[model samples]
Target: MTKKRHAEIAGAGFAGLAAAAALGQRGWSVRVHEMNSELRAFGAGIFIWDNGLRVLNAIGAYLDVRNGAFAAPAYETRTDGKCLSFQAINGPGQYRLLTMTRQHLHAAMVKAALAAGAELVTSSEAVGATPEGELLLADGSRLPADIVLGCDGVRSRVRDSLAIPQERNKYKDGIIRVLTDRTGLKGGEWDHVIDFWAHSPRTLRILYTPSGENDLYMAMMAPVADTEASSIPINPAPWIECFPQLAPALTRLGDRGRYDVYETTKLPYWSVGRVAIVGDSAHAMPPTLAQGAGCAITNALGLAVALEETDTVEAALELWEKRERPLTDHTQRRAAEIAASRVLASGMKWDDEGLRAARHIPTGAAMPFVDAA
Candidate 1:
């Protein structure tokens, strides 16, 4: 009898957990090791576009994640409180967008991954994967697996162990993210996500979206230099001057954190030997596109499909790389373009192809089992 395939996934973030859930559902014995004693979630939100929803559906966490989300039919762009473009994003349920807190989505994914029978080991840090198909844990013990997946995120030690050539670029801006309950905010759908832009002093943009239950996610983007000055006021007075619409949400800032934005070019290659990388470990982009987490989810589904189509570990990794690399590379480029435009209009070069392909993502979309593998 053939032995059941097993996968070792490092980290318990959305990508790791979702990939675990996907592989476990496919009859693969999956073990996920999280470096943190307990998974930590920031008081922030995420944009799960239709493309991402499709992957969630494939992994069996779509409905549960959606239950705690607010789906919006429109994406509005505003300048100085005046609506510039209110684009209707209406589509079939699969082609819609959902906004919710990272905590809720993470919690749902955790439940799905556990239910799917993926073993979750906490406080376990992966040292590296061996050529002999063994995963070296920090405690000097080794876990055997058919494959080792690096879902350990942007600062992935697995990716570092591969020693592949990679490029890292920092955006010229930083973000201030805050989460607060929507106690007194009025008007709009309350569930809607809005992008409000400001032109005076310097180009800046703020995103407002619903997070969890009665919670709001807001992030203000500005030049990194402007934010470096300790004298610069951290309050909302100047922001309110730029865009008055922010007054309602800014009045209730309960928790906040500063985010330094960075985008890394695609890795030279995502896999070597029995080890391979996924999610931000492969491509980390600025939030300008909001597709970081989305791509992670899809990568999980695609990798699972590749595994199902092939018997050999090398072949499966190759197929997974071929199918996923191009998409992620293009997404990084597109995200860079969007980030440029957000920072300064002079760098406005859009990815028309990406926009078109993304519009048709379906609710039941799953990775295809191509014969090439």
Candidate 2:
């Protein structure tokens, strides 16, 4: 038998919204509190993989996602538009990556959750917590619920209340992004591939795709001091010097304000007591695998499922921690590997001969797979 519940979720990002939707559909009275006056979209695009799409489908919002965004059907590797490694995921069961504006995805999730009977409160932030529930807003107003889930992100206050779990390390890196009007590039040329330019001490990674409405999205990554703010530009000329391959498309972004840049930040411990964390709050990874949002959505779904099967809130948190920690921890470590590869002093490269041999060393790979219920 399904039990009725009242759940309070902190943060309105992808993970929190997904949690709200999943819980509301299962008969929980849910409220999502956001510190932002309105849902804010980061200035970039995210590639939603199949695993995340499956969870969205489970919550009955896949159609909204599919219809509201563009799709990336293939992948290509290039150094300044010159082909290097080409990979296409067209086989049956392979995921058709959905590329869309972060705001659109957030809006879709928020709309789905509200329509599913969730109460969304804007400009609300969680400031404190008790063993029983969360304390929201700076005024010390209490929001008591059967469960409190912290999806508040890397600098989460909910995590602070629990035990102040420290971040494994600082992100100490930055990324630049641009959403172009239209580059007239599509089909086999554009496909669903991300072209990367490896310039030592200044690596460049770009995700190029059309988001259905003729807007082409591109994101570039570079190493930066931890003190650097997101407001800095990644200087396209230095990028060109390192990756002579993207000059064609990079030049087309001229005078357009689409080439914006931002910094990355993260935290380590994602949970404490009845308050548990999901997504970037618990484990923020770089965009190497394009799995940041995917991981968040999956982690949120896992929390919702654990809550559904548990009899008490504490039990639910325990289950969520046990199920999610290992996966997110692994994801974070792998992301570190990817991040190291992008740096020159790190002496790490994806195409390194030793790394290539290690990948083929017959070691077992353990990726978290969502159960098909």
Candidate 3:
């Protein structure tokens, strides 16, 4: 017989789909709602570390994630074209550092959730949610469940409905990504490993990661002192000067332009009663750590594991929050530290014990140095 407990997930992002898939594997009936008519990824590149991959394996989708993804062994940090350190992602040829398009990952998760028997409804228009798992849709219809997982993102309507108090601040700058394919980069124990470069006195930072054979992903972020700085179209020297190896790639990037950046305050708590917030709704850190999606995946993993350990939804949610909070708090703080500086902020060399503070394969490359905020 099917269990009476049901989990309603708001948002069809990596976090929501992950939670649905994980819960379904644990014998819970799951349904997911996305306001959009179609499920899609952000059209960017994302790095998934071991922690996230472990969670995907728990739900039996690790290989699905591996499909259409690149296997990157290590990530390097450089300044003035000098290698400061090279951090191995998973070790040689292992499933270590990896990159995939947002769309690919989204499709993979959708497949995993459906395979686990999770019902998904797009264009459902979730306007709000209740602590007892009732979701009010745009059509004035209400759906009931045993629990709700709000993965609605930074401006989550579910989080607002919960009256979850939060603080948000905008960054003076943003990032723009340029996909560079087939640099034909090879050889060196670190051939084709991730490249992160910063300048001395550090005003610009640049990063390069191979998406697949002959294809690379590039991101450039910088601080904006002037509101119209993006429109000004200044020289690239400040950001790319330290890494001459990228001269050709920078020219290829050719001013793809800018996007806005912002981060929210880490919430005081992740859940209220049976409804809990996961992913960015719970803790949003700057992209400097690249843990946003990875952490969200972990939150889904934690919530599902907690449910399997207890009989009640409330107990499970509480346990999940309790177990995941410290690590998330640590992640947020460390990312903030990176965002707070411009002088080559690489935590890769942190003492072994301090590694927990680093997010999985986090790197912010090719952007303007962040001025003190």
Name the top TM-score candidate: 1
lDDT of 2 by residue, 25-89 (tens): 77899988889898877756667766667666766567777775876666666554455655455
lDDT of 3 by residue, 1-373 (tens): 6655788889999999999988888788898999888989765677776666666666667677786788776677765566777666666544355677777788889999999999999988777899877877889988888888889888888888989878666655556665655454544533445446554554455566666555566666656653332332435555446566666666565555455464546788888877889998888887766677888888787788788888788898778878788888888877666666643434244442334633332111112322224
Model 1: lDDT of residue 94 = 29
- Per-residue error (Å), model 1, residue 74: 1.8
TM-score of each prediction: 0.89, 0.81, 0.84
What digit string (tens of lDDT, one per residue) describes model 1 on residues 169-213? 877776776677777653465555678777775567778776656
Error of 2 at 40 (Å): 3.0
Please estimate how well model 2 matches the true structure, expressed as its whole-model Cα lDDT: 0.65
Candidate 3 is scored at a TM of 0.84
> How many clashes show up per model?
0, 9, 13
Q: Best to worst by lDDT, what's the order?
A: 1, 3, 2
State the local distance difference test value for candidate 1.
0.75
Which one wins by TM-score: 2 or 3?
Answer: 3
In angstroms, the error of model 3 at 89 is 3.7
Error of 3 at 368 (Å): 41
